[model samples]
Every structure is written in C-alpha cells, then in structure tokens.
Target: MPEFTRRDIARGVALLGTMATLGDGSPLFAEALDAKTKAALALVNPELLSIARKEAAWRNGPPLTKNYLNIRKQIDGSVAPPLPDIPFAKHSIPVGKGIPDVIIYVINAGGTKRPAILHTHGGGFVLGSARSEIRPKQEMAKALDCTIVTVDYALAPEATYRVSVEQNYAALKWLYDHAATLGVDRKRIAVMGESAGGGHAALLAIVARDRGEVPVMFQCLIYPMLDDRTGSTRMPPPGIGVIGWDVPANVFGWRSFLGQQPGTATVPVTAVPARTKSLAGLPPAFIGVGSIDLFVDEDITYAKRLIDDAVATELHIVPGAFHGFDGAGADTSIAKQFTHAKMNALRRAFGEQSV
Candidate 1:
C-alpha cells in the first residue's frame, strides 16, 4: 500500500469532511435517525470518514456467500508496508493425528526469555493470513522487545469454528511448550488479536483455562467480534452498524464460521465468546472498541461481565471512531493514542515498565 504522509492524510480528512453525502450521493444515515444518534453521528472523527465511506461501498457489494473468494483475494492482494528488520521464522506444528499441522510465523526481537504474544489475524474469520501481518508484527516486536507468534488458522465455509479454534490452541500449546527454545518467558505469554482474531483469542483463552495446558497471562482484544448476536438477533442503535462492518457482513461472517445462522439457540456457547458461561479464571483483559462500531455494545458488555466476575479488565471506548479506524486513519491523533494505550497495556501485562 502507498504510504500517506501527514499532509496527505490531513488534506483527505479536510476534503472528506465537507461532504454531507457519500460518493454515490446517498445520505450517510437513514432519515429516521433519532436525535441522540444524530448527535453521535455528527461526532464521528472526520479523519475516519474516508474509511467509513469506502467501507460503506464494500458493504454494498455482492453477498459474501457468493463473493467471499474474490473478497479474500482482494484482501490477500493488498500491499503491506515494508517489513521491519527483525528475526522472522515460519514453522508448521502438528495439531493432532487427523488435523492438519498449524502454520505459524515467529517474529522476535532477539532476547533471552522475552515476553511473547500469540496473535490471530483478523478477517472476520474467513479472510486474512499470518503472512499479511508480518510487517506490523515485526514492528510490534521491535517496539516491545518481544516475540510474536502469529497463526495461519483455516478460514470458514471451508473450515469451521472448531477447526480454526483448535488450530489456534495448537499454536498456543506449541508456543508454551517451546518457550525456552524460543527464548520466551512462558509465564508472560499473552493472547492478542483484532476483530475476528480478537474473538479467536478470547476463545483460545477459555480453552487454555479449561484444558489447563497453557496459562495465558493477558488478552488484548481490539474491537473484537465476540458476539454473533450483534447484527442478527440483537441489533445495535440506528447509527451503529451503518458504517464499517455492517449487519449483513457480520451475520454472513458469523454464519460462515459457525456453520449455521447466527443468533440461533443452536449456536455453540463455546464458539461465541459473549455466550461463554463465565469469565472467571480468564486472564486479565484489555478491550478496546469504537463507540459506533457494530461490536461496541457486545465488547462493553463482555468487559463489564468480566469485571463482575472479578477479572481485571480495562475497557476503552474511543469516541467518534469506527471499526478498523486505527488502520484506516493510523496518522490521526486518536488512532495514535489508541495504539499507545494498547501497547502500554501489553507492556504492563508483560511485567515491563510502561512507556
């Protein structure tokens, strides 16, 4: 992807801010929007409006069930920023007898017994690869002086929730078992991911807790797609899901991953983190989401439930932000602060002094 200089981003934000309607001349929201929702919509950070417009166009595309392959290709074809100079390696570890070996990429800053994170990439569970995240993971490793193991779990419609979740668990097991060899401190292992990946991380934490094989010290969920019911049975307010990652795409993604319609009683509680019975015994968590994002309500409820269960939880609701705003508006001040907060949280989780 082409790099956007500060001037370029500022200019685009300014140009997009003056427009009342989308590029296709459609109203940004429905005419029936409530007074309170209208007020909230007006506060949407102008820097993220450009991304929201693009996401709206994407939402209008062909149904994911019919066009998911092409969409996956588009996501995989996008150019990533140059990889930072760091030690990177790939390995395939056997998950089980019949299950395929899980692939993982390890990005390390090269230190003895350093902190580590097992990260799952976000694509709503059907699109994305660990390779696509190497650059950012390398930068993160360099910045945090840690090692990051990113999993290439199988996608949905082809591979369901059980497959992907088991793949992630296998990766986590491998990370903990080989901690000494990888120069990682096993006691400091954390699980982290964004969007669907965040949901996967949450599930993995539950599995780790129940199985008692590996201990996850922390979980950093970034606007995690935790509840399948968000866009299905339980709809958000009028202005919430209208922007990036709307109801249709969310329902499709969940259905693909769950192998059934979301929000139905048949959906497994283990598959959807929000439906999990208890948050007790789970690791400390940092949950971050945008005020208008589709998953905002579910994420907040999960954090509150965690607190109720006596878990250490830090919840951040970024005002005027939308799903994936950090990536879309990385140069914006809000995005920078959000990233800083996440890193600091991870730092503290790893028992390192916060910057």
Candidate 2:
C-alpha cells in the first residue's frame, strides 16, 4: 500500500465531500450500503455533492506512525496566506524554564477597554500554526472591533496534552494580566477555535474555571474534535465520518496527541474535554457542527451536558453538511449562513449589537 502524505490528506479534505470512491477508483459500498445509509447520503446538500463529485476519491490513509514527523513538517512548512492589511504585532512570552516561549499575535489592540478573543488554531492537535490563521483573525478583529490574540500553542506527540494546555493557559493569563494595557476589557474576553483548536479552546475555558485566575466570558467551538472515543470505542452512524476527517484520521490524531490509544479507560478527564465530569461555572458556550460531520454527536452531547449543568449554551446544527464545509464551500449559501451565525454569536457574547 502507498503511504499517504499530509498533502494528499489535505487535498482530500479540501474537497469536503463524501468518500464515494475507493483508493482504486472503485465505488464505495455501492452494493453493501443499507437503505438507511443511502438515504443519509442522498440528504447531503446539493452544493456540497457537486463539489464532492469533482474531486478524486478519498482514501483512509494508513495509521500515522513514524512518518507522522514528516507529516508535521510538511504541514508546518506549507505556504501561509499573505498577511492581512490590518495592523498587528507579535510577541514571544516566556512560558517556563526549559520550555520555548509561547508566541502570540495581537490585532485590533489598544484604545479603550474593548471586548477581546483568545484564539487557537486547529490541526488535530498535531499540525497547524497561528500564523496560518492571521488573515481570518485580522478580518474578524476588524469586523467585530475587538482585540484578538492568536496563540502558537505547541503541537502534540512532540509536546503532549499537558504542555500545550499549559502554554495556552500562559497565553490566556498574559492576555488577562495585560488587558488594561492592550485596551481590552478583561471581563469580556472570549475563547474561540475550530476543530482541534476548538478542543483546545474548550480545554482553556475549563482550565481557567478550575485555576480561579483568569475568567473566560464565552467559548466558541467550531466543529470541535472533543471525544477520543468518537471513532474508536464509539462509532458514528453509517453515513457519518466518511469524508474529510474520518475514523482512521481521528484515531491517529487522538493517539498522537494523547500519546496513547484512543477510547481507553486510562485517559485523563482534563485532557479530553468530553471526559471532564463537571461543566458548572464554565463560561457560556457556542457549539456548532455539521449534522454529518464526525464530531456532530460529540459536540451536541457536550452542549447538552453544559446546559444540564446550568451553563448558557447555544448549539447550531447545520443540515446536509460535512466537516470543514464552511471553508471548503465558502461560496455556498449554507457556509455563508454558518459563518453569519458564528459572528452573531460572538457579537452577542461581546455585548455588541448583532449585525
């Protein structure tokens, strides 16, 4: 079997469609799919289906192994989008002895006390960088007129859960301590991220709550990869996780990040957000996911758990969509609506009038 490169997976995910073809270009489960599964596939949004058909078939790459280091290097070395025209500054803050300083980018900072966001970038906890997301963060900062701080947290396998979490917490603590200087209203700061970054954001909120130091006003989780058991011990319905970030990828990402097999009993509750028992006293949250995405069930369950614990939570489920649909199909109406809902949620959380 040919080993899959990170670029190959990235290209497949960029298409954001169903895995309708196998590695050898054969039909995917054409003869074996149950009626219920066919019905689910038919319900996929027409716009997304059109895009899905235009790409080469997606294959479940081999489990990430020794070659994962190569994958990480490829992702880190990928070309980043040009910096936005908006003004921003970068800083490297000391995390601890013998650890690299956490780098952060500040945008729309300074003036009077204004709402703020501490953003984390997603790469399944193993890949990605804050620099890659600068363009979108700059646009968000401009649109919302709030200070945005994006962190370059350490990735997993190389750093592990504890290191990354503490690094993020350090960034949060730095933002809170310097809010006045940055013209940010410390009390109105929110935490936000997409995919694994969303998981980190959720973890940061919980850590903030437990540490009794920094206060997080809101958490925005975009299709967060929260539960390690989603593709391991607990499986999704037939039509889910068949495209974009699928079962094999999920298992690899989780295993790499946790430094152990996913769905095991020994995983720490603090490391995986879904495993955390209490949601009380955590900030209000906005959780959004596509109905067919691998994480839909886990995200929804987390939202329900939060509401059950008396936390104010808003859960938005998009129909006929897959993971990363918003980015892959940005021009589609569904993606537009999803983005609008997210911005509106942030506006509400920041005490600004909705657009």
Candidate 3:
C-alpha cells in the first residue's frame, strides 16, 4: 500500500505554498528546539514541512500563480484512488440558456431508496470538478448509505458569476424530477458543498426554496466562500489560529471567481451567497468552518441567523484550521477529527449511528 501522508501534507498544494512566504511573520515559522510533536509527526511522515516551505515561497511569485492554477487543474482531474465496484453513472443536465451544462457524478447505493447529497467541489468556483469531489462523495455514500450526486458545475472567468448558481439550481430540479428513477427519497435530499461548493449549497437551498421547486432537506456548508464582494472580514480573525490562508490568497481567489473585479459591491447572491439577505426558510444546516478561513465570520454569522430563524443549525469551528482543511490528508490528527465530524454529521442526518 502507498504510504499514507499527513492531511496538511496532502491537498494543501495551494494553501501551504502561500503560507511559507511570510518568512519571519509566518505562523508556522520553524524553530530549532521544537520537538516531540514535530518529531513525532515527521517520523510518521517526512519532508512535508520542508516541502511546504519551498512550495510556499514559490506560491507568492507571479510564476507561482500560473503553476498554482495548473496544479489546481490537476487537483480537479484527480480524486484520490479512483473508485471500483461502486457502480456510478454520469449525465448532462441543462441549466440555463447560455450557461454550460451541469454534469452529475451518480453512484448507485443498493438499499431502500434514501436521501442523496448533491455535492459541489471547492476551488473558489473557478476550479475543482465533480471528479475532484469523487472521494468525499464516495465516503459519504459508504457512510450515509445513500446515492451521492456530485455536480460538475460551471466555473468562473470562463463562465463568470450567476452562471454556476443557475446551473446548480437546474441540476437540483433535474435530480428532484428523476428521484424515483434514481431510487432516491426526494424529501430527504440535502445539498452539501465545500468552500465555493458550500456557498453554492447555501445558494441552491435558497434558490430552490424561492422557486417553490424541490425541497432541500439540509445544507452542509463546509468552509464556504460565501461572498465574492466581501473580503477581509469586518471582525478580524484571531491572530493565533492557522495562517495557511492569508488575506492576499483570499483576495486572489475572489478576484479569480468574480472575473470582472474583486471588491465590486455590485456582485449578487448568484455570485456571492452572502449577498442574499433573505436566508430564512432555507433548511436545517450543518455549517463547518475553520478559524483561519477568510469566510469564517460570514459563515458563523449565517449559521447564527439560521438558528435565530429557528432552523435546526449546527456550527462547528475547527481550531487552528484553514479553509479547505478537510482534504489536508488522512495522516494527521486533524484529518481524522474532520472525518469523524463529517461522518457523525452525515450519520445523524441519515438517522444512522456514528460509524
């Protein structure tokens, strides 16, 4: 078997690449005497910390942006250790008149027809594909014992804002219409997304609710990038948390998604989910965000509002974590913690005991 790596060591190409550049100001700035934790972690897996430092410096330069974008594409194309015997189907679902068609990664879960999760991949809505989301969706299938449909939604810069949301809504409607065919319990269907995907999940819930179309059972917003218009939180992120994500990278991601300009207040909820004022009557939600993410404050506030509105809402604040920390790698304690939390949330939602 291939050696398992640390969570932070995997899937953190972009995140750690950016962190190592801060030099003396870096949160993980290394010291000579640090032992035990570092040594133990290093013993389990080696070269990650050093590799991250090199990768981080390169990430700050212009060439790094090109390399980073290229890496981002690779990430989309690769989902860990491709699935077998899972029996899946893929189909194109029409979204809008001008928007690119949405694709769904369909996996058949043999059992009594049950709930399904419409997963959206993160990458600031500019990168990441259904393929990139395969692993997590597969995990969800094994855990939730339900069909998991992942959307190959439109990306920005090429597709631009609103197009993705429009496509996601169309995909949800398509899924609802064909629920019986897919052996899915339409009423138990939930929308779960990570980062940009999470933002889309929130948007999908509202859009569906507003259109009086399909009912969204739950919204799992994991480290969501809500509003492209809003960057640099009004309430400052605590200084001591994970610094893998800094303001510059967050700004870069938003700009990449917006396609026009980064800080334009003109951006709509179709682009930035947080821009939508009426989040009431969406659905029960499980909101998970890291303390270091740019969207932490917004996500936390959104969760509180959902609760205040009497929606059954669960918010988890992962300590010393950055945005998109879920895919860090399976080798770290944090990764296991995230997995357990994810499994528990899905289990509870699906009426199963924690696995």
* Cα error of candidate 2 at position 6, Å: 15
Best by lDDT: 1
Top-TM-score candidate index: 1
Give me the runs in candidate 3 sitting further than 4 Å from their true place: 1-10, 13-59, 63-68, 229-242
Compared to the true structure, candidate 3 yields what TM-score? Answer: 0.81
User: Which sections of candidate 2 miss by over 4 Å?
Assistant: 1-41, 54-56, 60-80
Per-residue CA lDDT of model 3 for 37-110, tens digit only, reads 23222322231343323323333333323444554544543447657756678899877677778788887644
Clashing residue pair totals per candidate (backbone < 3 A): 0, 0, 5
User: Which of the predicted structures, 2 or 3, would earn the higher lDDT when compared with the native?
Assistant: 2
Better of 1 and 2 by lDDT: 1
Model 2 residue pairs with clashes: none
Give Cα-based local distance difference scores for all models. Answer: 0.80, 0.79, 0.65
Worst window of 10 by summed lDDT in candidate 1? 11-20
What is the C-alpha lDDT profile of model 1 across 65-116, one tens digit per residue? 5665654544455536547478889999998947788899988835799999
